[model samples]
Target: MSTDNTLPIEHLRWDAASARGPRELNADATAAVTDPGAGRWAFAVADGVGDNPAAAAAARTAADAAVGAATSDPRGAIMVAREALADAPDTGDCVLVVAVGGAGDRCEIAWVGDCRAYLWAEGTLRQVTEDHTLAAYFRARNLPVAPGMEHVVTTSVRTAAAELIGTADVPLPAGRLLLCSDGVHKTLPTARLRTILERAADPGGAVTDLVDTAHRLGGQDNATALVVDRTAEHTANSSAA
Candidate 1:
């Protein structure tokens, strides 16, 4: 009898980048939190209402609160974030997307407002969450969307009802997961975003390319990008080779 002795390596990885762009203050925030020994993690991105003086605070608060829920509780995390916001109106309002997963094949995603979550697989990028905006609402009914109405958000961390929160369960290990603010998506077209992600060497590289791409393209708002990878780049490269 022969005994095999090759132990598998474990690696959990994610990266994020934030830039002020043309704004005086960065109203965007990102968080990557882990629950040690629990085999679960959380990643979030928030876009603060630009008009509010406390927009940055709101963005940070929402992200921190959501990730602190300790595991992959997407909807419950959003609820915790909302309640946290309700307790501190001075922080203003923000839109957010939270993804909870680990080195697993699936993730739970929840969002309020326009922050977005996307999955990239084999050079294809698919948006996993919908924008809770008036534009989306009107377009859903086949109604003509007016100019600028697309920016009007229907729900947010500070104002969303329980039913207004959007939730999803997406396959993660088959690809990479991305959470980004509107600054990234609005400034970079879907094609451009996909190209950047496809060219990135890894999740950290992807974060830099995505955020810098938006800024270099003359973004008018704060930008943020968070990317999570279930598989190590070296492992994938080895398999490919």
Candidate 2:
């Protein structure tokens, strides 16, 4: 996913954490770019397909490129990121998810692959982006999920086409927001994530606990998490600074 529309958002706070898993190279990358002058912000996470060479580079390139483009055009940002990757053969490819907001109380989300975003509001934690893997497709249609289908993503930054991207525009809730790599979500359950968010001392601690918990729970993938609090009271305490 990519962002660059430069929508204006104000009085919000966020924090992020990432860790390499058991792999030799950490292929997960994250980005949080804020334009205080314009009150616009963008957040993203990319997981380079491990099978591809230079996966780490791919992840970083995808993330940075996405945020630096037409953020208002979430799907367009994905294309921009993809084109950027094509300029560097060494970068390979990655799956990504992103959220961009600032114009008003709404945010635009776009994704390819399984990186995810969630919204916590009104005492309910809800997943905002559905996974774009074959397993998810089968499950959505009430079909049987074949073994390992979850790992087979249908599209990615490098191979995206029309209709291949997933998108949603939501009212940026006033409670809490989360963007994370599969390593974190696939490892920690929703209930646990909710507890961590609700009990967190601040955004930084929530991100830290999320990643730390992933490792403690025997997660074998690179873990990455970004947490945001929009409530005025929590916002004061969770500044990205």
Candidate 3:
């Protein structure tokens, strides 16, 4: 890791973990890349839609491309990932959430399908991105979220237009940024997740605990977690005082 003298936060750290669960193969991919000297970071989580033949490959392709481009252009990153996955051989489609963090308490998020981003700060947790699924669409329209409809993705990296790509700039509170696939979120409730995050000592521990908890609770799909934490650097005098 490098250092950024101008970043008000002074220090940043990130960690990630993934598990295949009881599935035949792990089709989830996660990545965290940081330009520490530049005070920039990129985070991504991708879940290969299960029906796809080459689900794992598609997930990796999207995750790698998104993380590579997110530092400079988040939306462009998703577009590049989409175009790359389009050339995949019979891989079907995948849902993704990509985030870019800059100098201060602000980050930009781009997503398609049901992958999600959440912010946990000051002992409170809140979801920052909405799911792009049939169930979510119905819920938005005041219609019933039919059984078995939650898994039906409305748009994905392989399908959504550039304009259809969802993007948001969120203010980071004094805690952690979490990105995860449905495998983890679906199996664990929000209250349980908040408790796990709050008790973990560091980003690495938080991710590990989250993934493990997902499996222990019966994860039916590949699970992945990525966490980013930023803190202000304190001088010796300040520390002692």
| Candidate 1 steric clashes | 0
Cα miss at 44, model 1 (Å)?
0.6
State the lDDT of candidate 3 residue by residue for 178-203, as single tens digits.
Answer: 99999889899999899988899888
Off by over 4 Å in 2: 1-9, 51-53, 233-241
Clashes of each: 0, 12, 0
User: Per-residue CA lDDT of candidate 1, range 1-241, in tens?
Assistant: 1011111222456788998877888888887677545656788899999745698889899999988882757888888988888888789889999998754566899999999999998778999999999889999999999968878999999888878899999776546788999889988999998998888888889999999989898888888998876665534644565
Q: After superposition, which runs of candidate 3 have C-alpha atoms over 4 Å from their true positions?
A: 1-10, 51-53, 234-241
Task: Give candidate 2's whole-model lDDT.
Answer: 0.83
lDDT score at residue 36, model 1, on the 0-100 scale: 46
Clashing pairs in 1: none
Q: Give me the overall lDDT of model 3.
A: 0.83
lDDT of 1: 0.81
lDDT, residue 2, candidate 2: 20
